[model samples]
Target: MNIALPALVVFALLLPGFIARSRIKRAERSSLDYSPFGQIVTEAVLWAGGLHLLWLALAALFFGRHVQPTLLLGLMVSDAAAQARSISNLASELSWIAAYFGSLFAFAYGAPALIRAAIIRWRLDRAGAPLSPLLRFHAAPWYYLLTGADFPPGEEPDCIVVSAIVNISGRPWIYMGILDDFFLDPEGRLDRMVLEKVMRRPLDADKQPSTQADEELARFYVVDGDYFVLRYAETVTLNVEYIKLRPAA
Candidate 1:
C-alpha cells in the first residue's frame, strides 16, 4: 500500500540509528532522561543519513555499487503501483540488501562502544583531557559522585561512609553505615541506598560522632540485617565520607 511504503522507508532510515543509540546508551551508562525526544529523533535522522552516505560512497569505490540518490528518493515517494513495478528487481537483490543492512547494523552497534572504550583507556574523559568537552567518563553523575572517579586514579576511595538524618516515626533519627549500593528512580533521581553494618540512634539522643564518641559508640545500636535500605525521600540530611583503606597485613 502507498501508506506502508513511506512507513517502511522511514523504518529503513531510523532503525539503524535506534540500534546505535541503544548500544551507546549501554556503553555510556546513561539514565532515562539522557535526551529530549525531539533531540533523539533529530540525532537519529542525522546518524542514519550520514552512515548511509558514507556506506554508499565506500560501496561505489570498492564494489562498483554506485547507488543513485534518486533511487532512495524514489523509494521515499513511491506509491503502491511503483513498488509493484520494481518488485522483481528488489526481490532479485534481496539477499544482497539484507547482507548490506546486517553489516551496517553490526557497525552501528560496535563503533560507538569501541570509541567510548578507547576514550576511557586513554583518559580522554577526564577534565582537561582531549575531547573532554564532548565525551565524559560516564553519562550518570552517580558514578562520579559515589565512586569519586574524578579523583586521581590511585587515590580513589575504597568505600563510602554515609550518615543520614531521617524523620520517620514523628522524630528524627540518625543512621550511619558503609554504602553498599544505590538505586535510581525512573526520573534518574536517587531512589534508595543500601548500607552495610548500619548503626542508628535517635537525634538529640547522643553527642555528635567524634573522637569523644569513640569511647561511647555503644550508644548507637546495630541494625540487625545484612543490608539496610534507606529511602532517599525520607532523609532530611545526608553526609558521605569517601574513605581509602590501606591493605592489612
Candidate 2:
C-alpha cells in the first residue's frame, strides 16, 4: 500500500549530509588503517532499514483502523447496511498514522550525519586547497611471518606516511592505513585471520611529496587516538611499505 513512500522521501532529504561526513571520515581514517568501506556501507544500510520498518508500524497504530469489517458485511447481506459510510473515514485515518511513523523514523537516522556533513564540507571547501593523491601498495603474504616485530613503538601519526613509490603512475591509489594491531588474537590466532585478509593482495602506501599546499590544509593534522593527542608533524616518512613487520627503530 505504498508504505515506503514517506520513508523514501525522508531518506532522500537526509542522505546528502551523511554522504559528506562519510567521505571525510573515510579520508581521515584511511591514514591509520585501510579504510573500512564495506563495513561502513553495511552499517548505514542496516540502520536505515531498521528505522524505516519501526516507523511504519507506529504510523499504523496512530491512524484509526477497521476493527470489524465483518459487521458491516453481515448487515449488507441482510439489507441493513447503513454504516458502510464509515469505512472510508477509517481508511483515511489509518493512512495518516502510517505517514507519521515513516517521517519520524526517517528523521531519526538521517539528521546527525547531515549536520556533521554540512560542517565538514564547509571547512573542506573554504580552505581553497586540494588534498594530495592517496598512495597505495600491495604487501606480499610472507611478511606476516615475523612474529615478534609486529607492533610499532611509541605514538604514531594518525596517517602513517609510507614512502613506497608505485610502479604504475596515475592509478587510483589511496594511503591504506597501518597494518598494526590488525591480527590481535582474541580467540585462537585472530591475528592470523586478519593477516590472511590483508595479505590477499598488495596494500596501499602514501608517497606524496610535501608541498606548500599541504601546509594550508587544516584537516590534515595527524591525530593520536590512544593518548588523546594531536601531533602535527610536517612530514613523517616510512622507509618501507607493504611490510607487516614493524618499522625499524
Candidate 3:
C-alpha cells in the first residue's frame, strides 16, 4: 500500500473539522492555556467522528443504505474498492451526497455564530445575565470587558467610550471618542482600535489650571473624519468610561 493514499484519506475526513475549528476561533478569541493546535486536532477528530456517525445514521434511516466497511477500510490503502463503491453511492443517491457535503459547509461556517447567539439569548454566555451565575461564558473576554453586557440588567452601559493618550514622536497626543471597533491579532492581543466622534489635542493642552472663565475654551478640536484609527502599540495610556443614555419618553 502506498503511504500517500492513507495520508490523503485522513486529510479528506479531517478537512471539514479543521474548517469548523477555524470558524469557531475566528468568530471569537481563543484563550486556551496550552497549545491550541493540539486541541484543535483533538477537537477536529472528535467532531469529524461525530459528524460521520450522524451522517451514517441519517443515511441508514432515510436512504436505507450504509457505507460498506470494506469500502471504508479499502479507502486507506488503495483507490479501487473505495472508488467503485463511491461511484455506486454517488450514482444511486446523488441527492444524499449533495446534502451531506452542503451540510459540512454550513457546519463549518454557521454553527459557531449560531451557537454564540443561542448562548446569549438564553443568558448562558454571561452566566444568567442580570440575574445569577447559572453557567459561565468563557469566550471573548474583550467583548465582555468593553460592553459590560454581563452587568445586571439596568446597570450595563449603553455605550462604551474610550479616551486614549498615544505617544507620537517625542510628544503625547490625546484622543477622546466612542469606541467604534477593536481588533485582535492571532496571538489574541489587541492590535488596533477605531473610534467614532473623535476629538484630539496635545496632552499639554490641559496642563494649565482651569477656572470657570477658562471652561469655555475648548481643549479638543473635532477630528475631521468619520473614524480615528489608533495603533494600540503607540498608546501610552487608555481610559474607558461607560455611558448610559436614558430612553426617550
Candidate 4:
C-alpha cells in the first residue's frame, strides 16, 4: 500500500460517505440516537454492497478481469472482511470524529425538515385531525408530514393551517415523507398507545354493511395544506399522535 496513494484513496472512498452519514445524524439526532446501531449497521451494509459493486466495475473496466460467476459473491466476502478490520480500527481511532461529522451533516440537512414535520403533526393533532401512520409529511410551504399518496398533485400545502406560521426561505418545494415501515406490529395490529386521533369523520361510502358496524372513524391530520382541508380520499386513513421531538425552543 503506497502511503500517500492509500491515504488519498481512503479519503476519496470515505469522505463523501462520512459527510452524508454526519448530515443524517445531525438532522435526526433524536431518531439517530435512539437508533444508532441499527442505522450504522444499515449504512455499513449498504456501503459494503455498493463498494463491492464499484470494485467489480473498476476491475472489469481498468484491469480487464473477467466477471466470473462468483464475482459478486467473492467481492462481498472480501469487502466484508476488509470492512470488518477497517471499522474496528476506525472505531478505536476515528470513530468520534466520524460520528461528529456524520451528525453535523445529518442535522444540517435533516433536522429542519424533521422539526417542520413534527410541528405540522403537532398542529394537525391540535386541529383534531391527525394523519395515519402511513401518511408522510414534507417540509416547506407545508410543514406537515402527511402521506404523498394523499396529494396526487405535486403541489406543496400550507403548514400554518395546522400550527403557528414559521418563516421558511425558498419556494415551497415538495419531497416524499419518511416511511416508517415499523408502523404496525408483526401481527399487523396497531399499538393503541401510540395511536391518537387527529380528525374524526363518518364513513359514508359503503352503506351496505350488515355484519361489521359502520361507526364513524377519525382521520388524524398532520399539518394543514393551505390552512386546512379535511377532505379524505378512499385510500387515505387518518390517525394522530405527536412524534417525540426535542427541537430548540
Q: Pick the candidate with the highest lDDT.
A: 1
* 3 or 4, greater by lDDT: 3
Q: Root-mean-square deviation of each candidate, in angstroms?
A: 3.9, 18.3, 5.4, 18.0
Clash counts for all predictions: 0, 16, 0, 34
TM-score order of candidates, top first: 1, 3, 4, 2
Q: lDDT tens string, model 3, 1-249? A: 355766876887787777665554423445543446787689788767876787778778997877766655765656666666655655666686667767766776678667556655555546455433423444456667666757665566877889889887888888888897888876667788898988888889877857765462477878889888987888988888999899799
Q: How does candidate 1 score on lDDT?
A: 0.75
Off by over 4 Å in 4: 1-26, 30-32, 36-39, 62-143, 146-150, 163-249
Give one digit per residue, the lDDT tens place, for model 1 in 79-139.
Answer: 6666665554467777867877888888888997887667656656666656667777445
Residue 147 in candidate 3, Cα distance off native in Å: 4.2
TM-score list, all predictions = 0.76, 0.23, 0.66, 0.26
lDDT of 2 by residue, 183-248 (tens): 322222223211111111122322444356544232233433422211112112223343433568
In candidate 4, how many Å is residue 246 off? Answer: 36
For candidate 4, the TM-score is 0.26
Global lDDT of each candidate: 0.75, 0.36, 0.70, 0.36
Position 169, candidate 4: lDDT: 49
